[model samples]
Target: MPSFINNIVTLALASLVLVSNVAGDKLIFRNRSDQVRWIDFTPNTDGTNGIGDVRVEPRQDVEFSMDGYGPEWDRGRGWRGNFRAHRDGAPREYDHIVWGEVCFHCDSQHPEFNTFDVSVVRDPNTQEGIHWMYPRGDPGAGLSGCDHFPCSTCYVNSGDNWQTKTTTSNDIYVEIRNS
Candidate 1:
């Protein structure tokens, strides 16, 4: 190969490595509902992501970094949390809407693994449901039948111990819409 072509290839490979090293993994939330929605993240005592409610306008997208949760050692160790979505003007209570519970990087055997589940356990007997899809990354766990009320895809009671885990380290892109 030509010297110039060799140099160019080396630079391109170096650039790709640099970008991948600095680019943090992400959790993207895209709202396809017509109504505005608010996302509330309640992290563990030492976990991050407690920046109050995040508003997402209709047909909009919001991205969140999956990093910065818990301390340096705990980053890959374990961090549990819950995040819920509510319509505009809804009271800031978990019982008023559907929610999701997550255990980010909580696998002791493999810290890269994460467990999560959607639930209506705290709901006030309302007919609220949410639909989520991983368009970019796969968690490699759980079933998806969240098409209607009382969805079989979610936990209906606190006793529901069912959960799913992400087996990959790629950026996760989830689209949540009203159902």
Candidate 2:
């Protein structure tokens, strides 16, 4: 009887951990540059839908929240995508970022947690630009990309672990700088 009771308690604790891991997250994008920019999210090949492009003006910000569940996709469970910034009349920028990306109950080794990251793997206009992102209040928890073409903190390749994962609720912040 004691062994059965222990098993029940362990299952309860595991369920709690899973709930905390899959909870929704809030994202805040701040444009500190000198011009307005539009941010677009291209969902991963998983078929998860995302909101339309977001517009943030200079010295301004926008907040978005997503439930880390449902909206079934081809391969994953939650909404996942890469956000790219673009100028009004100019071309699309290559610096990209992602937030609230998790494949629920997948990848035991990685533990599907709400993750965020910035990348410059395809930075075409790397001549002069800076992009960074991190969980609010914890600058050390995130990374910056495109500061100088191929920054080590940025995801320049598939082997990079620039992505930040969170188990607790927090605000993810992103900043775009054009020079």
Candidate 3:
């Protein structure tokens, strides 16, 4: 009886550990920035469909310093990244939960929208290449309009163009979590 009880307890503990680890891998994004920033996310591929790589484009703008610092000196800047799918394979459709925003800032000083646009696509025949877009605005909003096909395009008016001109090292955490 004693041995049987011990086995059950051990099994319970092991199950708990496994559950925690799986939960931990559920995708997390952290904001390591010192100032509040704005961000946007767009899906680049149907990694959710077990397709190719999952790519995300992150566009950010750190509000100009409240104090008389010129916009050129503002520490806030832009970023573009591609996050590969988790080891469990592509995320499920319902698991698609994208969330991001100004992690920290000196207050809502800048009113202009600091957003990120993204596009995801995969080639059925050729897995050798991937296509993407930046500053893809809301489709229904008709802000930037939607591209009929996937391409390597960037939105100049959407604030993603800042990366082409300069680099801002500001820490902005953007993440997609599966619930």
Candidate 4:
């Protein structure tokens, strides 16, 4: 009877520690529903409105890269995978979540011609949201940006059918948190 009681207490304590540890490291991704469409580059170019560019400032001690997964260019257009960070010259996998937002762009002669999906990646290790800024409406304009972590590069595929214009350039910003 005494041995059984002791075992139960030990199990309960162990479970509590495990639960707390897991909860502490968990991260949540917040998707801003307000989709801002850019119409003109000159006036709308700012962080206040539109899908901004990716910018990583100073760079992070560790660098990570983004890869897209799933059907080439079907419904899962923004499904990103393998955001690997470097540690001691080796790649380490960080737990992350991807959320979506809308992007509006322009073409040669047409105004407000293209619309696509944008995916934002968040690292569970850091509790900061990535910040991006771009002049509203101009998808082809140069993007100015910064981030908490150093972002080396990002790859985007314009699905399977269209390969003419798939990837774009932008500044990436990473937000880092101690806790």
Best by lDDT: 1
The lDDT per prediction is: 0.59, 0.57, 0.27, 0.27
Ranking by TM-score: 1, 2, 3, 4
Residue 28 accuracy (lDDT) in model 4: 18
Indicate the residue-level lDDT of 120 in model 2.
58
In candidate 4, what residue range of length 10 has the lowest lDDT sum?
36-45
Quick one: how many clashes does candidate 2 have?
0
For model 1, how does the per-residue alpha-carbon lDDT over 41-80 read when each residue is reduced to its tens digit? 7876563534567787889888876555543444444336
Task: Tell me how far candidate 2 lies from the true structure as C-alpha RMSD in angstroms.
Answer: 5.1
Q: Which candidate is the best by TM-score?
A: 1
Which parts of model 1 have CA positions greater than 4 angstroms off?
1-23, 47-49, 71-73, 124-129, 133-135, 143-145
In order of appearance, the predictions have TM-scores of 0.70, 0.65, 0.22, 0.22
How many collisions per candidate?
A: 0, 0, 12, 22
Candidate 2 lands at a TM-score of 0.65
Model 4: residues >4 Å from true position, as ranges?
23-25, 31-129, 132-179
Cα deviation at 140, candidate 2, in Å, is: 4.9
lDDT of 4 by residue, 1-179 (tens): 99999999999997774333222111111122222211111112222222122222222322222222112322112222112112222222323322222222223233223222222334423322323333233456423222332232211222312212222332122222221
Per-residue lDDT tens digits for candidate 3, residues 1-179, read 99999999999997774333222111123222232222222332232112133333222222221121112322231212233222233333322222222211212253222333332322222211111212222232212112222223323223444322111112222322221
